[model samples]
Target: MAKLYFRYGLGKSAQLCQVAYNYFEQRNMEIAVINAKDNETIRSRIVVDGKNVLVREPNFDLKPGVSLYEKIYLRDSDVGLKCILVDNAEYLKEEQAEDLFYISKMLDIPVIAYGNRLIDEKKTSLGVCRLMALADDIEKIDMSMPSKRATLDFNYGAMNCSKTAQLLTKDQSLIDEGFKTCIIKPKLDRDELYIASRIGLRKKADIILDLDDNIYGQAEYLYRDRINHILVDEAQFLTPRQIEQLRRIVNDYNMPISCYGLKSDFLSNLFPGSQRLLEISDNIYKMNTVCSCGCGANFNVRKDRFDNYVTEGEQVCIDQGDNYDSECALCFMEHVMKIDTASRKRVRKK
Candidate 1:
């Protein structure tokens, strides 16, 4: 069956794609690599017959009222004309993705697209989500490995130094200097590196934290090592097309994949990526967190600049000091009612 394989991982999706590449190469199949402008790792590693191949991004600017397909076809006639391999699959827009999907079906050429399942904060798959839904078969590569823990020491204020020093057998130094140094050893648990920052898209930190490395690594590993399992963390940030690419990865490749992430944003609204995952995921599971009230916290609440409840705002806010609270729907409603009541009272006093 014509399948779209989604090998997902926190940093392993590209590895899976690499394995797939190896599988096809062993059979001497011709491949085409495509990706967005931002993907550098996969772009660097693309080789044909043990020789590096340069995959250029096609430039197609559609004029007003022009069709996207026409623009794509104009730029690269080979899209549907021949068997092609695509890397950096997330860059394709929805309509473009649809065109590619139909092209694969009509031409009887296997178009393997490898890319991340999620963007940073959007759940919408860049390219793979749509492909997964439409593909004849699906596969998921899950790599949810256990994390390690360690302890590290930090400096604390003077008052607790003597008591804290007692915990340590050796007296490194005890001068009773004006400044007191307390050692604080905190247990550090292993967490996935959130490459993308939760800042504005245009911010430098956010750009630097892009997930291109994770995607490329997973694809490379999969193509080279024949690994199948894939896992994606913080998947709520994926774009729609990226989610489609993930779906295609599973449906077409027959790889079982697991994705871990928040289901909604700080506002309790579904991110595009999370929404897509909910729609297309074969198995759904919820990782639980609790509210201060000890109730199951399924919703997120945001606060305004003045630390007041903010019911409406932009989809995402990056400024620190903006308070966020996780609550259940019931508690969220109560807070909303309270805010409303407070507003009414203020108006009456005025």
Candidate 2:
């Protein structure tokens, strides 16, 4: 019995969504799609790397999974729908959401709603709020919505967070369970650090992602053929909106996604992406790394060519001109920011 999922899109997660839809379609599983999104989002699937995956379109037939109004005229035995998918669910009315529940209970199929969100955040509206409360399972990820569905797994630490290596160790387990997995490789991650080939994830990622451009159509096209779970490297670069979108993707598709990256940037600022993951993820993990001080480390600092801490610079510098290293938050502040947080804490204690 599939549970209702309230999936949201963060950043440019629209494309990754199609991949999951395609996966379900390939398995011959029935699905429903409803939408209140005003902008006529391109729901068509575009082939990527030569695959015929399904995209944003709902594949449900009226015979089994009809619209709310459509079900009114028919008897329960006449409907054969397996799943109900609604887009732009924010536009629904509280009564409409209630109708869905009645329909779902009668049909014994899952009802999924899609909306735009910034990770764990939601817009307060009578309709959406009512729907959230009525959902059997609120999954914001590949697991459950409301950070309760599946689990939002996280792995964070300093530079070269060994999380990638650890995630690889879990690959065989997924394979053993008859699950197919793919990694989200951002195009901007062209640096040596983001190279899949260098990261032991050679050939693991079946798709390459360009956050600048929407890839939802292509993902749907490809995943319609195969894919089960998702993995992402350099998730710190992801925007809060994108993280929400990924969370929704996992929920709608029923796949687990693992994100690995630094918790904070060199200046100790929370990367927008990491902040959202921390706020909404179900399972959080910290990858281990040593700082320059040799004590247990988690913070990061940018360095100049002369091995000096670079204080003034852009937030994201992919160019080889800048370098980064891991350090403790205390060292990052005292040695880099020169704030001496230890002293501040000591004085505040008094």
Per-model lDDT: 0.44, 0.59
TM-scores of the candidates are 0.37, 0.53
Q: What is the per-residue lDDT of model 2 for residues 1-350, given as tens digits with 9 covering 90 to 100? A: 23445565431124335643664556655455555444233243345687534346543332323355445314333544556667666667666666565455434456767654322254344555555444444444433246445555767777866666766666657879998777675566654334343366643455556656443444575368577667777788877777777776666655567888767777656676776776566666666677666755656888888888887767888767677788754466566766545443122111
* Model 2 spans > 4 angstroms off: 1-149, 191-204, 215-219, 340-350
Off by over 4 Å in 1: 1-221, 304-306, 337-350
Report the number of the highest-lDDT candidate: 2
Give the TM-score comparing model 2 with the true structure, all chains together: 0.53
63-149 in candidate 1: lDDT tens per residue? 334443343443334443233444445555665555554444333345555555555535555455554433333333444653332
